[model samples]
Target: MTRISRILDADSYKASHFLQYPPGTEFVSSYIESRGGAFAQSLFFGLQIYLKDVLTQPITRADIDEAEEMLLAHGEPFNRAGWDHVLNAHGGHMPVRIEAVREGSVLPTGNALVQIVNTDPRVPWIVSYLETALLRAVWYPTTVATRSWHLKKIIDAAWSETSDAPQERLVFALHDFGARGASSSESASIGGLAHLVNFRGTDTLAALATARRVYHEPMAGFSIPAAEHSTITSWGREREADAYANMLRNFGGPGKVVAVVSDSYDVYRATAEIWGESLASQVRAMGGTLVVRPDSGDPRTTPVEIVGILAEKFGVRTNSKGFRVLPDCVRVIQGDGVDEDSIAAILDNLRAKGFAADNIAFGMGGALLQKLDRDTLKFAMKTNAIRVDGEWIDVFKQPIDDPGKASKKGRLALVLRDGAPRTIRAEERHEGEENLLGEVFVDGRLTRDERLEDIRRRSWR
Candidate 1:
């Protein structure tokens, strides 16, 4: 893919923004927030991904020339002189100060997550001109991370209520199967990394690569050898049992785990006869776990029934919490039609059937990555303050028809108030009140380069 000039990474109209600001507008303060929608709290993430990928590269003369040519040809007013000023005065680095809530911190909606202002007084419009790309950088992965974090809460509740499994089990309860479901490789990388903030299981290798390249983690996610439909159905229907045996033989061993998609023909018979009777002894003798995957049927109940059937053959044991669990040799993974609601319902049905949440895990795809939109969290970036003629003034929007669209006013500071995060006027901060927002990016350089391990630890905390 051709690299997009950073100057051209904005809306075409952004080229015209240099002229729209009030005369003598020397400084502009803007903020990004979740104005409240699907989730109460937003998980702040992926800003470092953006800063490292896009902003750190200083714009070149070729970039400015290319953007200027395109913008003029596209009939939008081009700020050639302003681009020249950025190139000459700032040495081609974006003259902006960006502060954000620490990556992986979870904060309530309607509060500031990130704030930006011009570091150079001459380019106040740069604050809002960069909104198109800046907000996209924060919203996508932040929303994905927030969704994954909430799923963790649901699974944690089910584990606590239904089983005595170690808390570590929650780390792999929801696996990332959203790679193919994502819109692009970059989307897969970022969205997949977001899911890894809460869990470690994933088939998205690009995510692990991203964690290493972007966040400085060696290997951030894990996946077991698993079979998909094509690999199973390729073996003739008469040879279905052979397919199950093949997975166990190749991927199974002492202390190892392998998954096999068993719904190629009939999931019921495959679970009952093929895995339970035909391959039962081999599965036990292999000294490993066989994760049976049912890819078609009611995601709410099919895996539950399969677990019951497996228990009928391999037997069951009651954990300390008095919930029944399949023998260590067998478990179920449901990958079809899964989302947060379905996962909760499935776990509820499993508990109702006396099965522990430990008996099953889930694989989420589109709903986990591609199905969400910026409005899913009602995310927005708005200018809240500006300085003109050396005097600071509050800026805001209050549309009569939509009060929810009302934006914040004045320069903001996110501080701990009553043990919770509260957004308030920066000047209202009292002595010793530490603002959670830290200067992350200063004049195109990353002030803080966070590690994935620290981010994961923060999210868990």
Candidate 2:
């Protein structure tokens, strides 16, 4: 029922080991005995709790035991000894001061929205390894969330059509095809789901599941009937059509099927002949609707003609309810090569021909995620200031004139004012500071235990 269920089940967790180390790990024992080792242990425990909640899967005792076993198993004599020495140097818990922007806030590039520092002067280097992965995990999600927010703004503006329909207008679904080979698979999943918080149009099911598990977004987009089956079957109908039918039957028809790709064979012909009649009838008869997709073809002519056919030959009627009904009536969705400019052009032509804005939906993929210029959504991380001596130091970029790359050194605080989130450098924070990163874990216990759905909802808001 939940999205996380699609990717990982209880059985999978049961079979997997949490940590892997070498056997006869006197190293672990020795390390655990040391002060630095204790701090590392605390950090590790804290990390596990955060990750467990983030992952939304049970972190069992068996899983932890398995992880220890694996770590010991993989530890060489030297590694074990080294690990023990490293642990002993920092036996007590090291205070970690973390300041981060609220999860949903928009952040600019080259900004230190999050600053993690070891509060204990003795074990500064202890938490270094954790930083890379931790930052890596958080960065992509934030970027995706920001991008999705902008995208929602654009969609809202584009679909500013006057209608006397129901309160609900367009529910967006994002499909992250760029995940196939572009970004890290996990990053793609997280990013796609982040987008769903603001823009509900995403087809990254795995990410959706992750999002649902960590952030409760109930509905997600799927391209099984549109792209998946055909891509798997080499354009053959046996598997493709069967898969489509199965999905329709299982998911309960076209209302569930957001956009169906009929362009695999012939764009117009498929709309009129291939899936045009049967699919439309099946959806309509089931009290559902399908969005006919044109994945390839002249965007200008194909969509307009398809809409015309659906409105004219198919006897589709735009009733007061804003529902277009025809024996072959289905919303037209353009996927491949669709951009803002192209979408604007398509919408203009459709309007000129008396087509209702709600008569079509857009399944955006590569254009929104990958095709945009690299600099369109600028994102980066920079160290604002580092404490060298006892006194807090103010650090700034050498070339202060180039404000874009400048960094405000020291501890930083972020605040939302008048609807916009702003960052105040530590030196500039004359007022009280509001720390963004709270104590997620303390002494190997979860201090903040939130449902994944709750986090998702929060992220969206």
Candidate 3:
């Protein structure tokens, strides 16, 4: 694959957007928030991606001209002097800096994930002007992380309600099947790692590359050997049993787990007749686990029904919750219709039908990575405080038309009080340096590089 060089990356209006910022504004402190939408806004993600993709990445004079031309074409005001400043900088590096809570740390409802400021006094507009780009950068990862965190809570609750070994199986509960479904390779890399923050299973291969290139990790996530419909059905309908046998023969054995999509034609027939009856003895003797995946039918009930059938054919043991579970040799993974709402419904029905949550896992595609937006979590970046003249003035926006649009006031710091995250005015909360936000990127340098393992630990907790 050929890598494109000197890509023009800023939003078309980004230059003009900063024009309204007050002149002589020596300091600008803004924040990124989730606005308590759909979830508690646990994960603060994507800063690492932002630093690599935007700040540290080189910009050339030609790239700046391309952006200037784009602004010209769109009939929006463009700041020529600003673009010239960037072009003349060493390697055309971005002049602003980013400070924020460590990526992957969880915060409260209105906690700030990021704070921006201009490192050079002459370029005060640098930070405020980049709001469009910064907001766009963080929202996707934060939304993806938030949704995955909620799903993790659901999975954890289900396991706690059913499994005796909740922690042992928690990380393997949900796998990322969202790579091809993502909007772009960049989205796949960001959102896939966001999902991996909560769970260890994934089919998003580029996420591993993101972790390696951006986060500097040996390996961030891994996946099991799995088969899609094409891999299974290519054996021919008459040779369906051969396909099943070949899966077990190749990927299954002692101490291994492999997933096979079993809903190519008749999911029920495949599970009951072919997998349960025909391959039951072989599966038992294989010394590994066969994860049967059902890709069609109503996702809410099909998993429960499949678990029931598997329990009947493969034998069952009652869990501590008194729900029946198939032998450890056989399990089911549902990879279709797996968003938060549908997933909750499926688990509720599964538990009601006397199947332990451990009997089934999940793999989510488009919904997990691509089907969300800024409003999905009500994300926004607002200028909270700015310095005008020699005095610092607190700033905010309170729209009478929509009171819900009111933003936070004053410069902010995320600190720990009584062992819990508390958002306090940076002026008043000048105690110990327990502020959760850290300076991750300064000017053109990467300051606080984080390992993906550390990020996963912070996010999971």
Candidate 4:
């Protein structure tokens, strides 16, 4: 049994969720009743198989009855004749053998990792409707999850030096713009959450909420103080200063303020002069620290200079335990256009200037998520080859020499080989197969219901 099954008993599992259906039952029935024929027979067979597990449950009966009553009361026309015929059709008439590796496994592009076999010759037409969407739903999440895992490695490495300070070390924040109606918002949200197991910083509110609900990230990316007032007039209002003050007044201090973006007008002058005294004093007085953010210009020079100024003028006072006051006094966050190389440079510069590594937070946006070369990550699907016209023709994309879009074909099995998981193609038919995709739902019931935390833990692993 999968980990998902251990928590929920068998009976409780199957009564919750519904699986995807091709063309959907309502459409299928309408088409068949309005224009009755062999197409109707196919629709009938599909619905029966689709609802086999559903009709067995009392809950489903109640729902169906309720829906029927509503429809009848409203005089809504539904083809009950076509619906009942399809509902009562032969269960084994159209068999679609779907074979896929476990959903979380990493896959390559143009690979026939998933195979859908239409047992009945007449059901081939339905493949076009389901194939594309199904493949994408599975493939993109896995890809994003894999990418997030890779990012975890980088963050883990960078934060290693501050192991003594567990809270200070290893912060993971994700800003998934892909959720704002991106072509693959669902994939992006799932994939983004899979990788954001550590730290907290993101603009995607829904993704953040999901991550917290499912993953339990400590700090949330609430609001970043912007210097909007700096550009209010021709001279631009000292928006950065005003914004910081407003935040301080409302939030009571910078304890909850993770980071503040200060460079809306002039980064250098702002760091040295503007709000430096007043803001820093407020944060320090309140027993909180200010994280000054520079969203533009050369980070290599900006953070180094800002840290230097804060330390020089702030009086290097030691606490009761004798830790340097300035190092913990404030932190510098660099955002705009930051990449791995640029981040590395900023870190190196800070270290050389006696700035604590943990005192610098990297606010990575497009560079971390969007700028990655899609070519580096391979994701694809393929259909299983079946006997056609008495010829053993392999229906698969031939492997390409290109590293980015290589394809793996044939009826494959993913097994743990030599203690590490690997994929193996089945040479011939075998009985009692261990299907990677199990019956998540049976008879209109959910076989497994997992908490968001559980899913996040699985993704982290």
Candidate 5:
């Protein structure tokens, strides 16, 4: 991968922002908020990753020269004097202080998640100058984490109502299938790690390494041996049974779990006959589980029907919740056409059919990673306060056309009021109140390093 200079990782217009700010501007304070969108709350994540990956790399003279040449060629003004001042004065480290809620903290959308301000009096523009990259770094994974967290909530509700072992099964209900669908390897790694905040099952292999390297977790997620369409279909149509048997022989064992895609020829026949009859005894004797995957069908109804078919073929038992569940040896997974609505609808359909939620799990791909955008959560970073000529001034945007586009004002502090987080003026914080936003980064250094374990624990709503 080419290592583009982080200095150039901004909007072309950002190159000229240093000169646009008012003269004598000494400090600029900004905050990031979701401002209400798809969800009422969001799972805060990925800031530490950005601080460690991007901000920690000191800007070199070479980076400055490269950026200057590129920006000039692109017809944008380059702040060579500011770049040289940062390089010579502060050794190329961004002169900024960043305070954020602890990674993995779940908070309401309208509250502040991160606060940024220029530490040096000379470069107030640096606060907003970092917005383009900084906001991108925070929003993507945070939105992904929020999506995963809410999915957990949906599953948790269904499992609580219909499963005997909701707590045990909840961890593996939603598996990450977004690696190939992700825009890039880096995206797969981060988005995959975000899903791990709420679940333990994932197929995104890069997320494991990301967890180990970024959050100091040796292993953040797990996956069983699973078969895709290519591996199962390569046996030819007549030998479909051979493909299923091969998965059982190679991956199935005592107390092991193996998933096989059974929708290549006909999902109904494959589940009701091949897996339910020819290999029924083998599956029962394997002392493990066979996860039957149906890849192409109605997202809301197909899984429910397959679960009913499996229960008849393999037999069913009524759990303590009074919901029918398949034998431990056989289950179903729906990997296609899955999203928040489809997942909930499927669970609702399963409950309506008297099947336990544990009869099936979900494998979410593009919808989990690539389909969302910054506006999914309505995330935005706006300057809330600035210091001019050593006097503090509150700043905000109030558009008459869209009141929802309004931004917060004044230096802010996120504090707990009656056990709930409230964004309030920093000066209005009462004595003895603890601000949730702690200084996480300062002068190009990470002040607080968060671990994945703690982050996952904090994410549990």
Candidate 6:
């Protein structure tokens, strides 16, 4: 989390020690669930790197002792045995197996994206205990990844209607501005990389570090030299013309693109007078596009109006699709109030204004990362089946109040049905059924190392 909050955060916090789940329970099969209908697909599991950054500290004897000591200090209840198995190889070598769809795969609602089980008798409550930390790992990134994925589909659809290179532009269309807006640096890193699973443009530098350290992608994301309001307004709001000239002088050049925030003072005047009339010829001659950012005004109206303003000053070319696109030297970025709905609204507005989707891009902050929670898809991990004594018993919940809260039953396997994914009880599986959920994490080792590139490729598929 943050400086002070890090002291209060740990993986052990998410561990469940309910009376229903006792130490004698030999086998506990807990599966991740996404209730049903959601804003995006119910869940897109970003389970790969959760342990890497989110729940970083693993259990140790000293940690256990310290937690017990703190419990003593606070006169609160504590379970030392809960941390014992993880500290003592609770599941041992043949510990639990975690099966899930691929890291970047889009999972539809009402299926278990992740099914975890600690099969060893030594650690009965390991999976349930790990739930505290592990569920947060899956849900947070999954929510962000699914949200970004849905937004990309929307952005791609809009571009496809008006732009020739829809695929090429869609990936670079949305940039991450959520680093400062996030609750913590780690939140930024996790959610930023989740967004990158669908897009390349980002300003969250911490995500690059996470990709390098956890996912093993040293150069995972890319960003252009961009300016904020402080950089422009610092040159004196009265001297707005000089500020725009300075942007072109320093950051603007052939094959070198830079986005300048123009809403600091008189955005319309800056666009019409400074950018268009004064610097338009220099921008055309000096090479690469000058991406103007209108950081204020209605997202539905701002982008279209800016496109019209830029087109008048810099000139526009009619693409074969019959919509006007900005010349190679100029473009627009509608950053303020950019979210999924506003993104759709702005694109539809621009197309109505006879401008190609290629004329503008977007940047999002808090909405891209911190705005989500575990309940965004009603994510939960519940005991599906357990072995109390020697016999394996099928366990489930069928609450009459809310059927949505009902849990799955029996040993589960993620199998593909005619090329699409669905969960199956292993007992009822056909002879040649292909289970898509592979063992990514086992015991204390990451058995499967999914490259970000492979995940990206699969996401497109």
Q: What are the Cα lDDT values of the candidates?
A: 0.93, 0.47, 0.82, 0.43, 0.93, 0.78
Q: Give me candidate 4's TM-score against the actual structure.
A: 0.62
Candidates in order, TM-scores: namely: 0.99, 0.65, 0.93, 0.62, 0.99, 0.93
Supply every candidate's count of residue pairs whose N, Cα or C atoms clash at under 3 angstroms. Answer: 0, 38, 0, 17, 0, 3
The sequence of per-residue lDDT tens digits that candidate 4 reaches over residues 1-461 is 12211111122212221123223221110000101111111000011112232222332233334444555565553323322332344231223344443333333323333445443433333233333344444434444445455454444554453223364344433333334433444434544554443334555565565554533444334445433334322344545566666655655453555455666667666666654565667666655556677766776677767777767656554433333336454666666666556666766675565554455666655544444432334333444343444333344445466444333444455444455434455553245645343233332343433343444444435
lDDT of model 2, residue 91: 33
For candidate 5, lDDT tens digit of each residue in 232-295? 8899999999999999999998999999999988999999999999999999999999999999
Error of 2 at 89 (Å): 5.8
Off by over 4 Å in 2: 1-86, 89-95, 107-112, 126-131, 162-169, 176-184, 200-202, 216-259, 273-286, 316-329, 339-341, 366-376, 400-402, 417-419, 427-461
Candidate closer to the true structure by lDDT (higher is better), 5 or 6: 5
Off by over 4 Å in 1: none
The stretch of ten residues in a row with the least summed lDDT in candidate 2 is 26-35
Name model 6 segments beyond 4 Å from true: 1-24, 40-45, 53-58, 73-76, 81-95
Candidate 3, backbone clash total? 0
- Output the lDDT of residue 183, model 4: 42
Error of 5 at 341 (Å): 0.9
RMSD of 3: 2.3
User: Where does model 4 exceed 4 Å of error?
Assistant: 1-129, 167-169, 172-199, 208-243, 299-301, 313-329, 352-354, 368-376, 387-394, 399-406, 427-451, 459-461
